[model samples]
Target: MTETLPETAERLTVNTAPNWRYMLQEYDELYRYLPAGGSDKIAGHQRRVREAIARLLKRNADVRLQPRAVKPVTAHLRRALDEGRTASLAPAVRALDAVAEDLSWQYGYEKVPKGLSQNYAYAELAGTRGPVVAEDIILGVVLFAPGCTYPAHAHKGITESYVILSGAVSENHAGVYVPGSMIYNPPEHLHRITVGKSEPALLAYAWMGERENLHEQKMVFTRTRK
Candidate 1:
């Protein structure tokens, strides 16, 4: 049986759950900015994002996850603000930003290595501890160093969207997306991203579906010689 703790003299409990209502508020905002009929050709991607969120809620059914874990979701939702889906995802992005601002907490960054002296900052949204709300959005940020190649990869059960904020990054999806551009990845679409020029490249990314449960098949880089 689960042990129950007594309340403090001040009437406060030790195991208070995180503010899920607030989380939902942000989610509502994000939904407003997303594209309509996002699930039409991109149903799988949306499923993955939702699945990841479901897993998080299941794990942290009581208390809130640490601030660092939840912070990435805001960025992920923000990235969904590209053409076609911008109208539906706008409110959600605003809500997420508000939550981040209210919490006054942010997650740390890590490096995704591409090659020697080339790397990108990655923020994980679906780990042991993260924000738990709806099961529809996997959020994160990618920061690319100048001239860095992110290599080709494929989304498993979700579609991905990237919004460029700073510098220049090239995305090879369908063809190529230049700086100040946005790229959308349909489920299982193979692609790569590389930074351009001397400045750093920053982007917000949102993947729709259950990333943790789904297995992403890695695409071989045939152009690269071993």
Candidate 2:
């Protein structure tokens, strides 16, 4: 039998810290300040992200510490955080640092491409598999080493968005997205990311979709015919 959200919440209350709770609040702030760029679609995505976060906050989801883990790319985390502290995403970065030791960074792929493992990794802040147990939304951050090129990929049935917190990156070579920029990708929208050469990049992302999809989504890169 599956555990209901209320039951999960009740069982998780004891281990959650005040800092974890504050992190969610900071995330709410992060999404709240995102500029819509005069696009209703963008505004709608922002609204959904904030509203989902609001719902999670209202439920007071438990935030228990996961086992600490790291990746080669995380070595750049310190620099990213340092840069973010003075950037517009300062609040979110600070809150993330409070629970940094407990974050479990992963590649999210069954088979990571060569060199990619050392260049990138992501950690979930709130989701079905994260410190916060939620089914409707996923909140996380991805870190990339300088000059990293993340291969083309897309989330099936998931509408996603990323807000650059530190350094700079270009998605599909469209433009350089500096700190405080927002990028939106609808479901199954193929896209690729490349980080700037001089500094590591950190981006906060959110995914919203059906409960089943949100819980069971798989990660796979798009391959091109040679």
Candidate 3:
């Protein structure tokens, strides 16, 4: 039987909208296979992120197409993806690459700091203000130009984790992280990131917090006290 026009349109929408949801599935796979390194804290975090994504998938959240935008730092995104494709985290990177053109990169600051204006940006994939429209968890990617220093910052009431997908970064001068490594930061834990000088770094991050806190989350750099 010939389908009605509305039925056909709905089927088309369903088929075409799987791109973003596929990206989320890739994220779940990435988290599921990541090594916990025997740290119970990390193990728990990984499990929670995977479970939240599972629940989100069951809900079949609608995908909202963002107004495509780019920044100076995005010039390195291709290189980042290329490098990421050769790493252990290739699948996750490929998923992001699929939707790269639709991503809306922003500095997430009201008044942009000087040096950072051109070197760093983030695109949210799922959250209160992102395409997926969720309040319990936020998933996104952050890109950094070579030799960029992301000033010290902390998220209040939020436990955040970053999975390095490409290039390398150092957190608080503590250690260098390569592709497929996960860095975890508890709520209100002040941290700084510095990308290596040779290539851009791309990181996938997840934020888990109370509904109100997740909805009202703000990004602010810490003041340097002399």
Q: Which structure among the candidates has the greatest TM-score?
A: 3
Local lDDT at 216 for model 2: 88
After the best TM-score superposition of candidate 2, give how far the Cα of residue 77 lies from its true spot, in angstroms: 0.7
Candidate 3: clashing pairs of residues:
none
Q: Write the per-residue lDDT of candidate 1 for residues 1-226, one digit (tens) a residue.
A: 9999996643211123334434443333333344435455544443444455545555543323444432322332333323213333344344334444323233232332335123444543323233433234545445565666777767666667775545566667344443334567877777777766555555656666554532342323434447
Task: Give the per-residue lDDT of model 2 (tens digit) for 93-156.
Answer: 8988887888999999999999999999999989987688778999988999999999999998
Candidate 1 residue runs with Cα over 4 Å from true position: 1-118, 125-128, 131-134, 173-180, 210-226
User: In angstroms, what RMSD does candidate 3 have relative to the true structure?
Assistant: 3.0
Instruction: Evaluate all candidate structures by whole-model CA lDDT and list the values in order.
Output: 0.47, 0.88, 0.89
Worst 10 residues of 2 by lDDT: 7-16
Which candidate number would show the highest lDDT if scored against the true structure?
3
Sorted on TM-score, best first, the list reads: 3, 2, 1
Question: Where does model 2 exceed 4 Å of error?
Answer: 1-16
Q: After TM-score superposition, what is the CA distance of residue 76 in candidate 3 from its true location, in Å?
A: 0.7
* Cα RMSD of predicted structure 2: 5.7
Candidate 1 or 2, higher lDDT?
2
Model 2's number of clashes is: 0
- Ranking of predictions according to lDDT: 3, 2, 1
